[model samples]
Target: MDSNKAKNLEQILESSIKDPKDLTRYLYYRKKLKEEGLSDFISILPLGAAINWARANSVWPLTFGIACCAIEMMAVGASKFDLDRFGSGVFRATPRQTDLMIVAGTVTYKLAPRIKKLYEQMPSPKYVIAMGACASSGGPYTQLGYQVIKGVDKIIPVDVYIPGCPPRPEALIDAVLLLQDKISKTIPQQEAI
Candidate 1:
């Protein structure tokens, strides 16, 4: 089946339904196909479905804020920047639950290992955005603060770094848009990197 046929998210939602509020017709089709030992044909659904689903639902983020920049991160999710417009407004609390980790504030030495652990917990295809100067190069803290790490990137490979003491919400939105653009260009490999 052509992916163009699945462009209507509503139709995809309709076909994917299951049970009481569910897909009686779909289940019937599945059962008939199964009993006939034609499950090989059914395998294509997951492939097509996964591609469709990822385009729509990819980039769940871990919002780890340690300082002023966190507010900018919050503003991106609010009415103005509206991070939801790109499906990344959901601020995931746990690293295990998100793939896009936006380090919006200062990352101190004490927090470096925690950040590393969280990065490890995030599933494959993960990305890290070092937001604000505090998170990027430790901002003004780099001059005076001995405790602050020079940047989150000192400990993690940063995908995008928004440079500002606390970057504006618009900057965060731009960073996310860049991330989206990158995601769109990505192709799957035979094996995970």
Candidate 2:
């Protein structure tokens, strides 16, 4: 239905619910529907919902991995784990062609500048996922003097941090899912006339 009608219906339902538990449940589901991009309030959107939905589904990650986590990232792309099912299996070799960066390994101070440069090359609305303890916080290499960068986030803004010595492939998949949810919530800038 239309936005106004939907809002009115929602108000009526919320007002009519005498039980606090039922009202809470209704609000929770309503928020969940909006996050899932299934809400009927699309009329109020600046046509951004459709674009956000597409971005959420078709995330192309940059094919740059630094450590052992790269192996797990590769496994996620393989047929068994099947990351392609989520439309994020095609990892691009260049930052210009990708919207997602999965820092899947340790980040050394020497490599931090390159990571920052790559992140800068990415298009607007790009996302970064730190996919291992190393990438997230230097992992076991944190004490290696001025070698390990401590965290990839020190160079680029990370959207999700999956912690593990080298997080499992399943963890990478979950991080992608989490990133999709974050992308879906973004309100795009309305186009000027």
Write down the TM-score of every candidate.
0.69, 0.75
Model 2 TM-score, all chains together:
0.75
Kindly report which residue pairs in candidate 2 clash with one another: none
Tens digits of per-residue lDDT, candidate 2, 58-153, equal 999999888799998999999999999999989889889999999888787788888889999998878999989988888887886568888887
* Residue 109 lDDT, candidate 1, scale 0-100: 82
Stretches of candidate 1 exceeding 4 Å from the true structure: 1-57
lDDT value, residue 131 of candidate 2: 88
Candidate 1 lDDT by residue in tens digits, 148-182: 99988888898888988777888887887788766
Against the reference, the lDDT scores of all candidates come to 0.76, 0.82
Q: Model 1 clash tally?
A: 1
Best-matching candidate per lDDT: 2
lDDT at 48, model 1:
34
Clashing pairs in 1: 18-22
